[model samples]
Target: MDIDRKKSTYLTLGILFMILLSLIRWGGETLQYLFYLRVPLISGALLFMLPIICIYLLPSMLGNLFVLKNKWRMSLVIPGAVATGLGIVIIGGIIGTNAAARFNVSPCPLLEALLQDDALTPYLFALILAFPTAWAAYWSSGPASKEMSNTDRKIGVAIGSILSLLLMGAIYWARTGETVSWVSDMLLMIISILPSEARAGLVKDDQLTPGLVTASAFLAVSTILYLIGLLLYRPKIKKDRWQLPALSYVLGLLLIFSFLFGLLTFVLDYYRVPVLLSFLAVSALAYKLWKVDHYYDIRPTPTEPPKPDDFIGALKERLAHQQGRRTLVVVCASGGGIQAAGWTSMVLTGLQKRLGKDFTQAIGLISSVSGGSVGTLHFLDRFGNEGAPEDSELNAIFNASTEDSLGATGWGLVYPDLWRFSGLPFLHTQPRDRGAAIETDWKSFMKSPNATLRDWVDPIKQGKLPVPVFNATIVEDGRHYLISPMTFATEPLEGLEFNRLYPQHDMDASTAALLSATFPYVTPITRNSEEDDSQSKVTPVFHVADGGFFDNFGIVSAVDWLNEQVLPKRVELEIERVLLVEIRAFPDEEPLQTASRKNVGFLMSLFGPLLTVLAARNSTQAQRNEDIVNDLKTKWTAKDIDIFDFKISFPKNIPFFEIPTQTGYENIDQYTTALKDEKKAYTPPLSWTLTKKQKDAIRNAWEILNQDQSSSVAELEKVWSRK
Candidate 1:
């Protein structure tokens, strides 16, 4: 792809991905209160409306004010926006359900909170009419109506004026209605986390003061200050006129508001804020210019060059095929987020380090899923040139893999990205979707600029870079979606051929890496469609979810290649021995006794089957992979060919120590004390980013290698030594 096309694809995907994320955010909150929690019908409707207006409508409206070149075109979009807003509840509920299962969260609080008199009932009818009425009134007079005739605009202005007065009257009627408690709690929480010196009047006699001077220092809201900030935003007027942009004050305030919201949703679990907070006028105008314009969408139309190739076409030039008699290797990488990423990279690095030229020369392809794909992508990034040792640049790549993504993504979800959805702040901001944020951050965090996906095409075909196949799942059709240097062997495999389906687009290298890893609701599901296909708007948009949903261990596709491609056509291609390597994040499965559910409630009855399915989604696919491996070994063992399976499991010994003890506590007091004293086990976090401590824990993984891992490495070494 030319430079312009690449940028366009990135911008388009990035922006749309951002928009999808905000929708997800709205859906998540909306679904939580109205559907999942199943609050009273009236109360639920009250809870659901603001997320649509504030999160979905407000930002888009403000954004359109500057972006919509044809102000008349926006009228067409309004109906879509309103329809989309209403449709969000159902679509959002599906996302919520999937996410709830993945994260194992239950958002409903005690009945008292939902049923409280002060919660929502008194202001119910007024809010029901007021919010939407205000929305309509604003739209008629606001940016969307700018192209209207003077007479129409004046009439709109009149209606808006009357509605604005009525809204003030309504506000007076509901004076400080849970607004103070909600606002005070938010302030106190944010202030408490700040340094004492930064939080003046935050506490007196060990009690928090909920006044303007306390709770949050960032709350300096003023239209005049904001305008002054923007007026002085010019960098060219005096490049060093000031170290800090005057805009920082406004941004600081906006950021505080978002951070507090995140605190409520994820950390505090405090959702007692009387349904919705009225829109803040300052917020609507604050980030209007903070848009991710598509040139970088400079018409940022990111796309890929067409170097699409088929599976056989890709394999023709590999040294292993040319050699005719040497053993060929295909590796299967498992899915376990970054933990799996670290482990997969380590295993590959060890192979290259230990086996040297033999390993690099013998390897044919790496079939990877989720985090495995991420790791494999990293390895392949620097492996484009054979002049460099295969593992030469791996240290940097490995460190890049460990850099923090979840931190930025956590905030990205609520704040900066939510405001504009498709476009970043003109300054170039991170995306809010977990997949986009991680992929975006991951790419930026790379020590050096990444070579694009197509950059490796020629080198791969010429037998320089090894081919790595990452898989995602088709939501409509449960098939493996391949993201690889060469497209899949579609004749043999029952899956989606990505390059074939979308020939014109080039996914960002970061996006390609994480496409397989965006498990559950961590990121927006990919929707593939053409820009001009208006019919696609109504059709069920094609969805591509995390590859792990179909095959957490990437062996299924690897085995399919052996079964349908390699074995059937061995004579046409140079026949050789096959060595299949399975690298897993988990230890071998052990049978265990099942626990009985003592009680079953209404929610349980509804979701029990759904929960069972979610829990089994990975394991079932994993077991199928194992079965496929075993079947291949059995079926091909006596075939007129050679085959072997090597297993490298992540060390069972993580960072922490464990011991089996026979002794038991004698009494209730002793048992309770023992439980309290017990340390939290060192389970690897399932996040896109890992901290230094987490990395440290994984650093010694190979050192504390389990028997299976040690044996596999030793055996591979022995085999290579003889070869």
Candidate 2:
């Protein structure tokens, strides 16, 4: 074949490849809307193609600007195409991940939300990304061959310019005929996804007119395309060796900076400070403590030491009489949304039955954060309450079907909308009213009818509950605020200082549980304000967000509370043994090291940093916990402190909603039949049964406690006989 003809054939194939890629990207979204939402197929197809054409033309125009010889230019083609495609995927992933995180939903749900809202900003951002992506592809393709005939080059430029104009014209024509105002539609869509309070001020009334704004935007975009086409017509082939390398360096730097900026913004928006800042603050605190050498004295002095007859003091005396044979059981549950909550309920139910009548009395402390608190709070509320059934009833309440747990009414589907509307500061008549709507529905689903906040607090205060249960939440200052019964105790110790932060506030068990269980964007941030007459302004609003943000499992807070408060006060009873029970929802899976060269994999890698941070934090906490346990074990031998970690694995295919429901015996029977009918489907193991897992965990706990108690008692008897 003639060299020119061969080159033309390759160019044509490249354009066809771009179209195929575009079709795959946008076509999937179009089909989803068409089948699921019943969006007009024609409209969906047309809407989908608009972005495709825009993206497809970008690489074509970029490739045409370069005039290169056969082998070198062809080599550039593959690299350019891959770079552009990968760039789009990576950028989309970053956008989608941030959006999902901000909205507190999964990526698929966030995409659906954007589609339903008809949000244009995401599309516009994609369009904006195309320019740099196209440029990167163009640069990789190498400079146009200076040896090419002028005639052939002119012909290529004319073809490209005409095609670009035609494509732009078609997009504009299709957009203009639409009844929906795309600009205002997009603005409203963006506002809808924002938190309720932020939505009102996002756009002004003047910005609501779609026609003028849309026209202006269309004109600006068309002009930019036209200019780029003009540049392609008169190709500038940089022959200077240094120039291309310098340009590549600049482009790479810009891309890296852009990614870093995005990451910083994401961290700051969610955490109210940069991750680095948080890290530095933690380091500084550690340094300050080290410098003090005797930092324990820095803690506030307690109002008074407890007499032997007082609450904790009496408990200490009882344990002393038992000759250190009493087990100090500390249960630490991790957060994993509603699934974790169900697991917690299962574990607690098993513990209750295993302990028999002494279920409430045997528990030393139940420390939890996020979803785990939901079950812990519920259990504490109903444990010894009148008319509350012991085991099966608890399971029924916690492991209820999704319809029953969330709500049978369709209103549950719009629970997110409630979070949006109810978060508005102006709309809320009272501070509690801010989250009241969503909280009411959530509490209805999760709260135990007999569990009052007082039930959890009263027991701890009166020493009926051995040690106060620790429920943690992250306040505005990015610190863990421990909400325990001791928070309200008359102690002036630093451990109880967090309670003073929200003084006079009635923190019912349900409310505290709700606050601790708040899972970022899923639950609205609870804001409380107080007027400061002296300053002539309301004091800085105190925001209570997710406890998981600070400590997902409450292990850190539990250990801190034990070391700082409980141990110091109990002079007669040293923590001879510590049993840490950790309940995890999923089995430990291998980390991703090598990803497939696919768009989904590329997108997933965008969350690598976030996953790393979470993994590191969990690992650090686990190590710290082990260190505490080891210190006790080394001092009193390995029999002193034992950590019982339980990881309950459910079938990966089981939907999160179904996991909780499947825990109940009736639900299990129904699911089992369903699984049989679909033989290829994953059948959940019998161990996945919530009650069974709970029983297993409790039985394990008992064995550990009994073994330690037996050994300690035997040692005590030996000493007594010798004396």
Candidate 3:
């Protein structure tokens, strides 16, 4: 066959294969829903094998059959016989079912009905259709005398098109009943899953007339077939490829317009007028500021005072001595869901295990957000209490706290009766206060009571653990707020006051941790009294949510602190490279794209512009982060600042661990034993601890750090010789 003909044939077969696979999957799901079939092994194996055979193997085999001259006759005969047999079985099953129903006769249960009662009809029909298409191609490829005439070829194409249309009609009829419109059915499915508020304007009633069903079904089938025909008979590929660019531009515009419309609708629907007007006002003000080239001058907080007794001064003096030389290892944790906490803990534990006690000592700063804060604070507490623990001890601590810290209870919300009835509540909550239950539980587990900021200050003063800084975002102001122990540790401690320089007030460790990790919607927003009463005398409280709202991973903050604060102070013997270890929890999949035709996919596409904006913003932020790092790298080539970004995704379908509770003092020993057993089993396999992607990241970072260290030593030796 010629290249053009071969290409056309492959394209046709590929489309057919995709359609068949979708039908097969839909059929299997429908069957499972209609009749609770438990053929897990059989269904899984068939679902896996069908795509390989139909899409890949069969296409290659058919291509070879068409190309081979002499072997074409035999190839046609084999497929023809298989097709004939499948057709017979399908027809026989239909006939037998009709006859049995007409005669009021039932088939024997033991003997069974024709090949599982036509369950394989869809597959058989797909195979049978392929045989005739292959035969037509072969006939067309034959010698001049044997080749089909123009009229015959036209008729053949018409017949194939008609058959495809009919098949689609039949599938639609089977999927949606005579009294239900397919579009309405789909909308109903979406409505069932959507929240109560979103159900407005959607078809609430599923009732539809037979005529409407038939018309809608026909329209739906015709639309699908038209699209398929367009794909098959698409305009020929031109050398200039002028159409490609135009097509892309049009699609891009459509996507942008759709996204904007969706976003505007959502803003109007959710926040109503005042918030939207406020946002618009802000945008106008920002635009005016930008026009004057003074937008960047609007600082969120006042500049830091040049006090030698401040935290930065303390850090500078501590690192002034050569013996006290340290690398300010700033660990930025990424926010995902509950899995983020687990992954963060695992990453930190792994780092400590591989790099040893010195690694812990070198880490002078730790900044985290949401789930990352949970893991960071947990590790700091453990390290302070137990020093640099062995691998086993670290693993045990992680396992024990992983469930309570990352589970639903960690959100400080009470679950419904069903959740408790299913014994999931124990894993998530403690018997104490319902709100901030996770914080209470964590405090109890650590055997530490909630202490004022002064308690934490003594440690940093004595050079015990690193200065822990957690981040949260204020919703109303739309600014990133940094919470640290030092920020709250005032000399003349009086009434709580929000400092203009620090922009954060002193709170207990539990509240600080909870505020830092308070994910929006999941955990309720925290309301705290502010010292400044200028705004309003009635309510002078600030609302704080998850730090992820402003900076999800703490990457930008880490770099900013390193350059603007640490480097300028000339900390360490000579400021060495600022190493950033970011642990991400999300998978390495393409963002914002969803499969077509799915309800969720449809919703996502409708709101595509919002996602696009978010994606663009993230990309820009990442570029800015890289620019900052690159700037440091250029200026401090000797120190060699480096970044190691690692992501560890949670394994699919892993069940949450269950925790045991005590009934009374008599069963305390049993509960304790069960808890130990649970902890032991809670630890997943080593393979699950770190994915290959994460391992590679860790290895690369280790190599970079070692290389820089070696280079620094060589430079020092040369300087010493000169001296």
Error of 1 at 489 (Å): 2.9
Two-way TM-score contest, 2 vs 3, winner: 2
Cα lDDT tens digits, model 2, 96-123, are 4334335343345543333222244434
lDDT accuracy of residue 370 in candidate 2: 72
Q: Indicate whether candidate 1 or candidate 3 has the larger TM-score.
A: 1
Instruction: Supply every candidate's count of residue pairs whose N, Cα or C atoms clash at under 3 angstroms.
Output: 20, 4, 0
Candidate 1 Cα misplacement greater than 4 A, ranges:
1-218, 221-316, 320-324, 387-390, 420-434, 445-450, 491-493, 534-541, 596-607, 656-682, 706-710
The sequence of per-residue lDDT tens digits that candidate 3 reaches over residues 580-689 is 56666543334456645544556787988887787776677556665766776576555553333333333322222222233223544464454333322222211112
Candidate 2: stretches off by over 4 Å: 1-311, 314-324, 385-393, 396-435, 445-456, 466-470, 473-475, 488-497, 529-541, 569-576, 589-611, 632-723
lDDT of each: 0.52, 0.42, 0.44
After aligning candidate 1 to the native by TM-score, how far in Å is the CA of 184 from where it should be?
A: 17
- Identify the leading candidate in terms of lDDT: 1
- Per-residue alpha-carbon lDDT of candidate 1 for residues 75-170, written as tens digits (9 for 90 to 100): 322322222222222222222323233224443333223223233322233234334523432333333223244355345445534544443333
